[model samples]
Target: MFNNWSELLPTIQKAFGALGKSNPKMVKAYMALGEAAAENEVLDAKTRELISIAVAITTRCDGCIAAHTDAAIKAGASREEVAATLATAISLNAGAAYIYSLRTLEAYDSLKG
Candidate 1:
């Protein structure tokens, strides 16, 4: 029934927190990687936040979406940029799902033949 991530907070929160606890060391390492990326002068803070926003949207992560959206704004990303990043995310999600659906249909066709 939930068509968008705005409607999936509870599910996202449970799974996201579980992942952080499931492997603290790994999660720390991943956080370090994110910090490294954020510190990269070539990328700029705004770009880093934008990337985070893109990742959050693609993954349908409510907590991440909220965090990164805030970070993006603080890093000077315009509202338009944030909206565009979400749109891009939606397009990529659709493409990925379509690919899998097509593969399933192809498999079904093979079985029918």
Candidate 2:
């Protein structure tokens, strides 16, 4: 982990506080967006937060991982569920890298020929 997940929420609050001091309107907008997306009723909180955690991992966003992991737990996700989400993220990230390497190989082959 990029940071202690336990400290995630507080750290975010602190960071956002600093950002808000500098750009209050932008911070307000961001917070509003988060609230809107999260409060949507189609998916339950647990599932939405679990998906957020997976996307955070896939995107390699440290802040997102920490925040979403905390949120996922709060939303009633089990440790096993988090593990499964992370495993899926890992698999997809690795698969994407492997597939993209084909383009690298193709470039090398073209240069050689």
Candidate 3:
């Protein structure tokens, strides 16, 4: 794990606070966007956080993974759920690599020919 989430979230928040000091309106807007996106109409908070975790993994965003993992637990995601979400992320990443390798093979064949 790249971050100890318990410690990292506060550090991230402090960094954001510094950014807010520099540009208050933009920071406010960004915070508001987060709130709007997290509204639980179509998806519950737990589901949203789970999806965020998966996206964080795919994007290789350590901060996002730490934050959303915390949020997912707070939103009532079980250990089983977390494991399943990670499994899905792993499968999707591998599948993407597999598909992209086909393109690599095609390029190699063209070059060889």
Candidate 4:
């Protein structure tokens, strides 16, 4: 019931450590993928973290939201920037719902026909 977002980071790290102990190879591969993504030269860390935040929101991943928000701040993202990124996510989520509604209506039409 703790609403402390920052505190969630350490908890996630501990869980990840325990998971790594259980399945080392999968964890190692995941870490390597993260490293490879981090090493990409074009976007820079701050932008990536912002994108990660948007993705986490769309995917409804609380752990990702906590970690990426922290990473974004550490990468020098301002509050304004994070808010802007969230706005984009909101727009995209709404758009996705709109598109799916159209598809659902289509299905209804086809079924009725």
How many pairs in model 1 have backbone atoms within 3 A of each other, for residues 3 or more apart or on separate chains, i.e. clashes? 0
lDDT of 4 by residue, 40-99 (tens): 678999999999999999999999999999999999999999999999999999999999
lDDT tens digits, residues 1-113, model 3?
A: 65577898888878879999999999999889878987656888999999999999999987888889999999999999999999999999999999999999999999999
Each model's C-alpha lDDT? 0.81, 0.86, 0.91, 0.94
Ranking by lDDT: 4, 3, 2, 1
Model 3 residue 6 distance off true place after TM-score fit, in angstroms: 1.9
lDDT of 1 by residue, 19-86 (tens): 98999888789779977876758988888788888888788776787777767888999999888887
Where does candidate 4 stray beyond 4 Å? none
| Predicted structure 4, TM vs. truth | 0.92
How displaced is residue 30 in candidate 3, in Å?
A: 2.9
TM-score head-to-head 1 vs 3, winner: 3
Lowest summed lDDT across 10 adjacent residues in model 4 is found at: 1-10
Indicate whether candidate 2 or candidate 3 has the larger TM-score.
Answer: 3
TM-score of each: 0.69, 0.81, 0.83, 0.92
Candidate 1: stretches off by over 4 Å: 1-27, 111-113
Pairs that collide in candidate 2 are none
- After superposition on all C-alphas, the RMSD of every candidate to the true structure, in Å, is 4.8, 2.3, 2.2, 1.6
| Model 2 segments more than 4 A misplaced | 110-113
Error of 2 at 109 (Å): 3.5
